[model samples]
Target chain A: MRYERPTTLKAAAQMLAKEKGQAFILAGGTDLLVRLRTGFIEPDLIVDIKSINGSKTIQKTATGFKIGSAVSGAELGEHAALKKAWPGVVEAANLIGSKQVQGRCTMTGNLCNASPAADSVPALVAAAAKVVIVGPKGKRTVAAEEIPVGPGKTSLKKGEIIESIVLPKRPPKSGDAYLRFIPRTEMDIAVVGVGVSLTLDGKGVVTKARVALGAVAPTVRLVPAAAKALIGTKMDKAALDALAAACSAACSPIDDKRGTRDFRIKVAGVLARRAAVIARKRAGGK
Target chain B: MSGITVNAKINGDPVEFICEADETLLDVLRNRLGLTGAKEGCSTGDCGACSVTVDGRLTCSCLVLGAEIEGHNIGTIEGMAHGEELHPLQKKFIEHAALQCGVCTPGFLIAAKSLLDKNPDPTETEIRFGLAGNLCRCTGYDKIVRAVQDTAKEMRKTNSRKGA
Candidate 1:
């Protein structure tokens, strides 16, 4: 295997494009190394992007935040401003793995790994996060949910690299929260995960909302019907019931060792309601 | 094929070695540099038995490539002691009998030290969560928790005395 650390994103993309054999991008290596050790994947070329300029930074852009693809969860947790601006996204990123894993894992890696049960995807989708992709043809931006197509797959074309994920600026009285149901307290994959983000007017009515669910579909789903249930309502029991029903109706999960399809569908609605409650509270609602 | 030469600082000592692109840092530490304190309980990152610090960040050495450590600083369980004097956590672990078969002891010690380094006086829950990555199958973890708590108190007392 050939290992190359490129100091520029263009060079890294070039390396990946020029490689005749299989190539893999080494971000945190929490996932890549595990696959490598288990003989799950044997790539002919490994491109390490940590040396790429601005790949390890969390910058405050005029619109929102630009988190580098190489930034670790620990670094995100330490960024006081980013944490405050998008607590749910930060918390979801921090939930990816154990403290040891958190030291090296990146949100971009988690998203690109494209695990339907990935802890960070639902939250990023609900937050309307966009990734800046750089490839042989140049740069393009896409919604976070557009990246994952299926289990362990991504929409990123060959030689296309995600440089950074941009989060939109949060308006006043806007809050987001992510919740997942796991058999254990930690180190287990999510059976069902939910993320809810909403903005409230002065009268405590939801004006804008987005609801996302994970591990219950081929890709992390952004449920407009569920979000519509919350919009224009005070998140009362009636509106919450509608929200729960919508989330349950959207599930097309499969029966796996972690959970049954019916159980995951049931938990999806439950987690969505609970997440909406927490998000409402964070937005300064009673 | 010729291996890649890597220059790194392991436990405050500058060292250089040649490793394959696919060689994990855990292998390089044990095979090439002869630092076997970090055990390989699971080759995967699930088990923290290979716990070490890369640039002072607690990490599973098995998950990191040796070639990636070219300019990084590494802290291992071997660095936990100062000469003949054992670190307080080590002394407390011995007093509390925190080990059974001794395989996971090195990982636990490194993890506890890292927790204390970040939060000098971690609550029981904090200590439990901080060291959650390191799994000890032989010991039930009560004694290990107590050892870390006792060490924290003793270290805090020493720090206060030095301040005075």
Candidate 2:
């Protein structure tokens, strides 16, 4: 195997594009190294992206924030502006693993790992986040929800790397939160995860909302039905009930030792409702 | 496969080593450099027995590739003490009997030191969450938590005396 640390995205893309055997992009190596150790994958080439300039920065743009693909979860939490603007996203990213893992795990790595139960993806989806994909061809931006197609699968074309994730600036009276259910308190994968983001008008009625669920399908799901339930209401019990029902109806989870299918489906709604409540409070609601 | 030579700083000293492209930092530290302070408990990130600080960020050596540390600074358990005197956390751990098997002690010490560095006065709950990555099966963790608490208190007093 060969290890190449390219200082430019184009060079990295070209190396991956030209590789004949299996190749994996090394960001934090939190997931890749584990896969290598478990005999789960053997790649002929490893492209380390950390050397790329500005790959570890969190830049604030007039539009939103551009989180470099190599930025660790710990760094994200330390970015006060970014964390204050997108608490749900930062919290979700921080919840990926333990404090040690947070020092090495990147949101882009979590998204690209394409695990249906990835803790950060649901929050990114709810935030209506877009990823900057760079490749030999050029650059393009797509919704975060479009990246994961299935368990352990991504829609990124060969050699296309996610350079950064762009999160839109939050409007006034907007808040978001992510919640996940795990058997143990820490160092455990999510059994069911929910992320809720909403904006309220002057009257405190939800003007816009996005609801996302993870660990319930092959890919992280953006449930328009659940969001629709919250858009026109003040998130009262009736609105929250409708939101929960929609979330429950969206689940097609599988039965695993961590959680049964029914349990996950039931917990999905429960978590969604609870998350929306936290988001509402954060938005300065009563 | 040919070896990749990397230049890095470990335990406050510059070191150079050659390792395979796929070799983990844990293997590089233990096998190549003979800095076995970081152990391979799980060879996965789940267990923090291989905990170390890469560029002052607490990380699992098992999860990092050796090639990634070419220009980084690494802090292992071996760096926790002065020439003769033990670090406050180290002394406190012994005074409080924080270990039974001693395998997880290195990881616990590194993690505790990192925690105290970030937050000089962490609460009991904060200490527990900060050290959640390192698992101690022998000690029920009460003793370990107490040791960290005592170290924090002692360190605060010493610093306050200097300030005075």
Candidate 3:
């Protein structure tokens, strides 16, 4: 195996394009290294992108923030301004693994790893983040929800890499939260994960909302109907019930050893409702 | 696929070595260099038994490629002590009987040190969460937490005296 560290993004892109599909882009290496040790993958080329310019920075835009694809979870947690703006996103990225793992893992890796149960995916989807993809063709942006097509699969074509994820500006009275049900306290994949981002009006009614669920579908499911249930409402029991029903209605979880199909479906609604409540509270709701 | 040369400072010593692309930092440090304080608990990042500080950042060495640690500073369990005196956390661990099996002790010490660097004084809950990555099955974490707390108090006293 050859390890290539390219200092420039153009050189990195050129190297990846040259290797065709046999090269794996090494981000934080929390996931890629394990696969290498276990012989799960045998790529001839390893393109290390940390040396690339601006690959590990958190740049603030006028609207919101652009987080580098190689930024570690610990780095994200230490950013006071970024944390204050996107606590749910930071907490979800922090939930990927243990403290040491957090020091080396990236949310981009979590998303690109393409695990249906990734803790950060649902949060990114709920936040309406856009991934900036760099390829041999050029640069283009896509919704985070559209990146993961299936389990262990991504829509990124050959020689394409995610440069950063752009989180749009949050309006006033906005808050977001992510919660997941895991059998163990730590070091466990999510049985069901839910993310809720909402904005409220002066009357404390939810003006806009986005609900996303994980581990209950092939890809992270964005439930528009669930969000629709909360709009213009004060998130009372009736509206929360509609939200839960919408979440349950959208689930298609497989019966895995960690959780059964029926159990995951039920927990999806419960988690979604609970997450919506937390998000509402954060958004200064009644 | 040839071996790549790595240049880094391990425990204040500038060291250079060649490692394979598939080689992990923990493996290189233990197998090649014969510094075996960081144990490979699971070979994956799940277990913090292989925790080390690369460039002052707490990380699992197993998750880092050996060649990728170029031009960085590494702190390991072996470098925790100076001369004949043990680090405060190291002494406190022994005094408090923090380890029963000793397999996870190095990792816990390294992790606690990492936490103290960030938070000079951590609450019990903070300590628990900070060291959540490093697991110890023997003492049930009571003694380990106490040891870290005691070390923190002692270190704070030393700092205050220096100020005075």
Candidate 4:
């Protein structure tokens, strides 16, 4: 095995583009290091990306925020402005692992790891997050959801490295929330996860909304039907019921020891309704 | 592969070491530096037996690569004591008997210390959430939780006295 900690994105990309053997990006290493130690993955090279400039800081945009790839969950939670702007995103990122893991796990790593149950992906999908990538070719932007093609897989080409995640600006009276069903109280993968983001008009009626579900598909699923169910109303029981049905209808979860497929299908709707309600409340609702 | 040189500040002291690319921080601290306080329980992040603080952030040392510690600050259970004087969390663990076989004590202490550093007067729920990563199979966690609670109370009282 070999290790290289390049201080520049171009250098890192050039090294990755030239590498012949299997290469892995090391950011936070909450997952990669464990994989390396357990023989789950034996990459010939490890590229430590934290040494790259601007990969570990959060930058404020004219509207939203651009968080670096190596920014740990602890750092995201500490950013009072980011938390205020995107509480659901921050909370979902913090929910990925334990405090120990939180201190080291990165949102970029979580999304790139592409776990079906990754706590960060659903919220990012709902927030309409975009990933900036640098490869041998050059820099480009891609939707966060487009990166995770399947479980433990990514669409990122060889020699491509994700630089950061850009959270788009939110309209006024907009809020988001993420909720996951875990059998354990903490540090467990989600059986079902839901993220809901919505905006309300001055009259307290839902005008725009996005609903996303995780652990129920190969990648996080953005259910437009679920969002439609919540739109054009005060988020009343009938609308919430429609949202739940849409969420349950959209699920394609696998049955395992953690949870049965039928149970996951049922809870998907439940969590979607609950998350939407929380989001509504956060958006200055009654 | 070849060994890589790593430079970092550990427990307020400058340290340098040569480690392989695949070596974990837990392996280096225990096998190389003889800081055997952080044990490899699960060798995964699930079990917090290898808990430490890298750059003042609590982390499972097993989950971090030794080669990545360049220009970082690390704190382990071995540094919880000042010469013969014990840190409050360590002293309180002894006072409360928060251990059975003692394999998980270092992790619990480091995790609790991390919590106390961030929030000196954390609620019981916060304490539980903070230490949830560190699992203790023995003693049912009641004793460990009580030890952390006592340590927090003492630390708060000490801080208030200093302020006064």
lDDT of 1 at A263: 98
lDDT of 1 by residue, A11-120 (tens): 99999999999899998999999999999999899999999999999999899999999999999999999998898899899888789999999999999999999999
Query: DockQ of candidates 1 onward, in order?
Result: 0.85, 0.89, 0.84, 0.90
For each candidate, what is chain B's TM-score?
Answer: 0.98, 0.98, 0.98, 0.97
User: For residue A220, what is the lDDT in candidate 3?
Assistant: 97
Q: Rank the candidates by DockQ, best first.
A: 4, 2, 1, 3
TM value for model 4: 0.99
Off by over 4 Å in 2: none
| Tens-digit lDDT track of model 4 for A1-286 | 9999999998898888888998999998989987887899999888999988999999989968999999999999999989998999999999988999999999999999999899999999999999999998999999999999999999999889999999999999999999999999997999999999999999899999999999998889999999999899999999999999999999998898789999999999999999999999989886
The DockQ for candidate 2, computed on C-alphas, is 0.89
Poorly placed runs, candidate 1 (over 4 Å): none
* Model 3 C-alpha lDDT per residue in residues B1-164, reported as the tens digit of each score: 57789899999898999999889999999988888999999988887999999988899999999999999889999899998999999999999999999999988988999999899899999998888888787889999999999999999999999999
- Cα error of candidate 2 at position B142, Å: 0.7
Kindly report the fnat of each predicted structure, to 2 decimals.
Answer: 0.75, 0.83, 0.81, 0.91
Fnat, model 4, is 0.91
